[model samples]
Target: MVLLVPRYDEPRLLAAEMELIDQSFGIAMLGCALAGFILALGLSIGGGHPGAFPWAVALAAACALGHFGRRAIAERLSEARAGLYARGMTALLTVIGGLWGLAAWLYMDVHSPATVICILSLIAGMSAAALAVFSPCLPVAVGFFVPAIVPVWAVFIATGDSAYLAMFLGAPLYLAVLMVFARNYARVARHAIALRFANVELIARLREQTARAESAQHEAEEANRAKSVFLASAGHDLRQPLHALGLFVVTLGRSELSDKQRQLLAHIEAAAGAAREMLNTLLDFSKVDAGVITPQPRAFRLQPMLYKLENEFAPQADARGLFYRTRDTTTTVFADPNLVELILRNLIANAIRYTNQGGVLVACRQRRGCAVLEVWDTGVGIPITQRRAIFREFHQLGNPERDQRKGLGLGLAIVEGLARTISTRVLLNSRPGRGSVFRFALPLTSQAAQPADASAGTPGTMPSRPSLHGLRVLVLDDDPEIRTAMTALLQSWQSVCVAVESESEALAALADFTPDLLLADYRLRGERTGQEAMEAIRERLGRVIPTVIITGDTAPDRLRNVHAGGAALLHKPVVAQHLHTAMTALLSESGWRPEIPRAAGMRMHG
Candidate 1:
């Protein structure tokens, strides 16, 4: 493998050596030629050797011409022809070196010993310069030096003097030293070129890897977006039937039923509740992932919020035969009230669900300029190993059978996501078989505590049913089941309901009966939305009635658009009691009356 690798790199090394030689060739040739010309002119004029002067001039001219010719050919030479061009350059340099040797032999006879010494020194200097210039290619360096120096040494050795013989002896040693220097320099140059090529290849590979990584990241993001779209569509479709079923269940509870039937209804209701919870968890995760939950921060009294939470979960804890306590604090907090409530709700709910024997405690304390809200429970505590994993989606500790009553594992996940949205941190302290304490901090505000309203009832409490008798309400929904179920529920409440499927139907209904309120499903059929239907109905009726937008879409953009319409918004599979509460509030706030003349044919559907 090692031998093959070097063989593969041999061509590149040779090319690099040739390139160095080619680049320096012309410059070195012209410089040496010019220096030799000046020296020849000085020696000939000083020694009065007119005969050798013409030869020196001719030699300089030939060298100048060779430089220009080599430069012109180098410009035209492509990589495929570079080897041929390099050999030609080597031959040209050898010829120039031979001319220098010939000039030495011819000029030495016509000049004194001093002039001869000067000429020999110039020739030696030129030979050294050639060695440096052609070192990138050892064969070319050898070609020039051998012919240039050997003839001078031979001429000197022909003399009988000891000094001449000594000069001949030193010439071969000098040649040998120059050859060693050239070989070392060539190896170094080849190594440098190989390193440069390796770096270029490395950089190219890194760029390719970076591009591939970015492409993979983009594809992952696209797939995630598609998943969100699918979930939103599927959730909406699923919610239509569930919404109608919930309303029907609530209406059935109002009717008389036998003991067996009543138990069956209770079972159905429990199943429905579980399904709704799982669906809501999926929707919440999609919403968080889509970044739809925007925080509306405000200053609010912590005591009232805690009291509300206590009231909401107290009944559930009581049903399970467990005590629920809340330690009230007058401290005010600066945060998004809704998000804070949601985080605490999830934490308390989890605590209540996990605890088999003991009660849950909700407490607040002023600590380090913040109100630290804690939910402590004496339940089956979490093991240290499983603490971090508990907050992950769908990760339950003790629910291998997936019990509905034990709850889906998304509560803590939702809690973490909401806490992050509100810029708060959730801390956990627990030991297996002991209990768990979940704590989160809220910044305390200097604002005075807003007194809790006596009129404001506990969370999840139904309002006193206001008189719906003779009240006209318009409901626009695309699903017939939901439309029929809503009409039945509203009529049961003694309200005159006009339910329609599309904008055209709603407009026709509006012409016949003027409604005091508008209830709409956000997603509708055939190039129209519930918001547009409501607007069209209001325009036809010539009055602004109170509106409610119910949706199952958890897509961020869709949710934000519906919220921006300035209507009371509700998500699908909504609690029937909460639906009624919202309706009561909107109706009471608007106090709107039917203004359009009622058509004689306008009759209420049961």
Candidate 2:
């Protein structure tokens, strides 16, 4: 069989084999010295040769030089010269083999069987040990094995004895078997070294990939944060003008006009209303995502909120040629009334928007000691694959072109978010062609709830115009257009109004007017906010005046700050009706009234 000589071109593998051989230098020297001294002693005892001691000393000195010199060579070995080192080690082992062969030649002439057996056995053992230590390089093993055995074979054949001749014939077969073993062992050693290198390379690649994944995740988090910041900044800026426009619209609606002019006005109002609705949708999503919506749960009858939503959406459903229906249940559930209403409003609106033919249904039933509220619709039903995806923000079905008329696609996402704040989740059940049902569960309360007041009004509903006639009001805002719009809108209500652009102007105006109510923007031109301005005004007045803090900011911290200041908080783009309601409620809470008529005491200051 051909010998397994690992390629010397692979510097790393060659260096690894060299290291393995270098480690065995001490053992190799010891074995050589012991064998040489023992053979010399055997020769002195058998033939009493005078040169035997000197010969042993020379062999020992050669072995000592070989060990130290190999170490010196190893210290100077570099990657480029590794092959040279391997060749030098092989030559050194061959020379050591020659020394052992000389021992055989010198001892066998004595013809002592004991001496001959001792030398032969020692050489056999040394050759076997060389295979173990030097098998990584096949050439080194072959170089040592041939020289040590060939001399013994020559000596045996030179004898005419039958026994020596037989041994001589068998010696070549023995050397061939050991060469086979050495070749197989060298193949295994090289395979193991290559495998170790492969494992190290794989580990390095794995670490690199892990670091890349971590970097990607960090980048995604930063991008999401940037998106939130952009929305907050943009929302506040955009809503400032939108808020002013709504106020102007309300003031304009109070003016007299012809039928055609009224119709055009109606169209203008509708377009403005649609824009306001979209902005409101964005605001709701931002509030939910910012975790600013805290649920205030209480025991309230669910019927009133349901009834209010029905009145709000029934006309839209009728306009679309679809039936609107609700089943009344006296199920008084414990939950945040406003959050529950918001959730139902989104569901009902989504149902009306998507359904074309069949009617939509809102119903409630008690299940497992909880009130389970459900909204059923005959819309294009959600598929199983898309059921979870529909709850993701901006995800929608059947509106790939993103038709704004179908809504901003945040209805269900808002619904889900609001439900979670109340310690629950919105669940969905749908079939492809039939319909879908959206539902959530709320705890059933044993306490008796108050009856639903049919006349109770929600925001956006026109309440019996709470007469603002002859009411003294103070408005502080930094925007010029907002100050103008507020002045005009409040004057149209026949309220004595004074609007200013800063805290100094507001404090200045206070000297001439004892305000009955305070209306201020949350953000102002200077360091003082509207809330702070109101507080400053209240401090100057020496009593808490009725206050409403209007804001266009949707950042969580901003909302929390406004809420904590103990003033009625109103978001921007407030509907005129809602603004009127809030002002009336605050005034009434402070026990103020219009003791004078509008024509007699009405005053306006810009």
Candidate 3:
């Protein structure tokens, strides 16, 4: 077997060099301060003025300050920037110090070589400390050369007047001391330079990381805003088409039509139903994710929604030849309506989906004095082992592939999500291939869930086709058909709606653009989008206006952009009920009922 030896990598080399640099500077600074203190103490004791000692102390203090300051300055620059200045400062300090030493030696005839060497060392240390006051790199060069030069100069001057034999003897000792200091200073200087480079690089990286984090935060906020706008806009667009379909459904139900036509209408109604579910789900998911689905405590009817659920699921259960029934007829509950209905819808759908022969039973019971709804189905029951894991996202039991007949595995997940929002819990009791019982507990309220009551709960039914008799609205879209239908709907609601083809057309109407509300499509004919149109119109109107973006695509990215553009987004296949409610709400007369609560784990069975 061959053994492979790992070599020192570049980062390790750089780090080692930097560590050497900082440690060397720190040691040198501290050592010089001690040496200066001792020398100045000796001088003052030996008849030198004590005033000079304070100056020595000051030098020590200044050196200490410079030491810290160098670290700080090195951190402030990017690595490349720090390295550039470091190289320049290092050269400058060494060259200047050497010249100054030469000049000093020429001018002074000092006899006490030790004192002279000490003073020169102090001067070099001081210079090293000061050079880096502005540029940290200078100290690196000062550390290496200063220790060698001052002592050599002292030894030469000391022996200048002495014998040649004495000069030869002192020269070797001087060289030895010079080499020690030289090596120490050299290592220190190299490490310091490397450290500065690393520190600068680290600082640059940190700054870059900070910038990226800030950008991501900004995008997330914008996405949330866009979601809000989308919910408002989507509710409106989907509602308009749904409302039209509802009217047509009502009309078709009353007409003397053939059995085949009735079946066709049923299919239309089912498609309409699926579309509406998607719209609601989009809003629900956004609200939950955005932390906007705050649960409000209010006493409202729960029985009405339940009774409607019974009627709604009755046909489906009958078609499946399964018995679907509920036990309790209790009503009032103090909980979020929007959330409760969502739970109920999931449980019912789940029960109906898997029931092969037996019927599903829906019942409400008073448990621990709290109203709890239970949906029991004679369907393919969940296994005990799989029950705990079922509530997770995309978890499906006994299903090989996610087929079209079965919806996404969000039913129970959503149920769980919504239930948690209202302090509710979903419980499941089942055996594989036997049957299942999904029950959720919730709080009760004062209002009865009856259609006869005017203010028991959020209105379960769609908004009535009331007169928009004297209202004014602006419809902007590049597509002609969309413009025409929107105008027709607004006109039928008794509002004056102007159909425009582009941002220019809308801008052309800016002189008279203040038409209560502005509706624009996301994609315009030219290089313009609805956001641009809304902004231009708002500027002309001289105030922030309420605007909605009607779009055919509901892609997350496009929705995110819509948020950036600061406009409400609405997906296509607009229904009248949702549109009217959203429009009315935007206009400050919101009448749309929030969702009702059901089982928390209802979404888990998806």
Tell how far residue 504 is off in model 3, in angstroms: 3.6
Off-target runs (Cα >4 Å) in candidate 2 are: 3-202, 314-328, 352-359, 383-385, 398-400, 432-435, 451-455, 458-460, 465-470, 535-546, 588-594, 598-606
Residue 436 of model 2: what lDDT? 96
Worst ten in a row by lDDT for model 1: 1-10
User: RMSD of model 1, in Å?
Assistant: 6.3
lDDT score of residue 570 within candidate 1: 89
The reply for model 3, stretches above 4 Å from the true place, is 1-269, 275-283, 290-292, 446-463, 522-535, 543-571, 585-606
Q: Rank the candidates by TM-score, best first.
A: 2, 1, 3
Task: Give lDDT tens digits, candidate 2, residues 471-532.
Answer: 88888888888888888888888888788888888888888899999999998886789888
Sorted on lDDT, best first, the list reads: 2, 1, 3
Considering every candidate listed, which one attains the maximal TM-score? 2
Residue 46 lDDT in candidate 2:
76
Q: Write the per-residue lDDT of candidate 1 for residues 273-299, one digit (tens) a residue.
A: 878877887788766766678897777
lDDT of 3 by residue, 316-424 (tens): 8899888877665755677766578778888899889888988888878877868888888888998778887877645777677777467656578777888888887
Estimate the TM-score of every prediction: 0.75, 0.79, 0.51
